[model samples]
Target: MPLLRNALTCSLLALVSHIATAAEAPAPVQSLRPLLTTLNERLNIGDLVALTKWDSGKPIQDSPREAQVIASARTLAGEHKLDPEDVAQLIAAQMEANKLVQYGLLAQWQAAGHAPDTPRPDLAKQIRPQLDELQNRLLRQYADVAPYRRDPNCPVWLAKARQGLTHDALHDLALTRATGELCIRAAGV
Candidate 1:
C-alpha cells in the first residue's frame, strides 16, 4: 500500500498548491481598483501638462488635441473589441478630470511667485509617453470590466465598489469621473 499512500500524498500536495495559488490571486474588486487608480494617476499628469502649458503660454483647453486623443482612444477600443462610446466616455471624463487638476495647479502657480522647485517634465517627451502607457493599461482594464458593465446590477455593484476605496482616493475627481460613466443604470429595467 506504499504506492497508494504516495499517490494520495502527491494529490493532496497538488490540491494544496492550487488552493494557495487561488488564495493569493487578486479578487475582482482588487482587479478594478487598478483601473480607478489608473484614472487617478492620469489626473496626476495634469500638473505636468499645466506647468508646461503655463511656461509656454499655451491654453489649458486644447480642443484639437483632446479630440485627437479621443479619436485614437476609440480606435484602440475598437481594436480591443470594446465599445467605442464607453472608451470615449471614460477618456472624456478623464480629460475633464485632468483639466480640473490642470486648472487648479495653474491657478496655484499663478498665485505663487515662481515655478515649482522641481524642474518640469517635457510634455511631449516625458509626459505623453507616461499617458501612452496608462492608456494601454486603461484599455486592458476596460476589457476586464466590459462584461460587468452590461450587468443589470452594475450601478449597485459600482456603488458598493466605492466602499472598498479610501476616502482620499475617492476625493480625487478622477475616481468620480472614471466610475461615473461605468455605472450607467438601465432605465425601467
Candidate 2:
C-alpha cells in the first residue's frame, strides 16, 4: 500500500500548496491566441477557438485502449496531486519530441530526394530518445513544483491535470502542441 499511500499524500499536498500559493501570490495565465492561429495555418486544421479541450487523453482515434489510457491519466492525476503546470510540461515535452521526429523525417526525405512529400523510416529511430528526454524534463519539473517525489528514472505523464496553468509557458505549450500536431499530420500518423 506504499504506492497508494504515497499517491494520496502527494494529492493532498498538491491541493494544499495550490491553495496556499493562490492565497499568497496569484500566478498569471498567458493567452495562446497566436499559437492557436499558427497551429491552424501550419496544420490546415479547424479553427483554434473550436478546439477548447486541452486533454491529450481524448480519443485521438476511437478505441478502448485510448479510453483506458485517458481514464488512467485521470486516476493518476487525482492520486498524485498533479496540477495544470504538470500538464503543460507534459505537452511541451511531447511537442519537443514531435519536432525531433519531424526533423528526422525531413532529413530522411532530403537524403532520398524522392519528393517533397515522401515518407521516411528514420523518424521511428530518432524519436525515442527525444521522447525520453522530454519525459525526463517533465518528471524533473513536476518534482520541483508538485508535492510528490518522482523516481529519477520513472516516466510520468503530464497531460492529466492541465487546468489553471496560466503562465508564459502556456505559449510554449501551445506552440509545442501545434508543432507536434503538424508533424504528426505531415508524417500521416
Badly placed stretches (over 4 Å) of model 2 are 1-81, 115-149, 152-189
Off by over 4 Å in 1: 1-27, 150-171
Once model 2 is optimally superposed onto the true structure by TM-score, how far is the C-alpha of residue 42 displaced, in angstroms? 18
TM-score of 2: 0.25
What is the lDDT of every predicted structure here?
A: 0.77, 0.36
Score residue 105 of candidate 2 by CA lDDT.
36
Name the weakest run of 10 consecutive residues (lDDT summed) in model 1.
Answer: 164-173
TM-score of each candidate structure, all chains considered together: 0.74, 0.25
lDDT of 1 by residue, 25-83 (tens): 75556556667767767877777888898889888898998998999899899778888
Q: Per-candidate RMSD vs. true structure?
A: 6.9, 17.2
Q: Candidate 2, residue 81: CA error in Å?
A: 5.1
Candidate 2 structure quality by residue, lDDT tens digits, 34-133: 2233332322211121121111222222245334433444444534456544444444444443343334434444477633432322322543333334
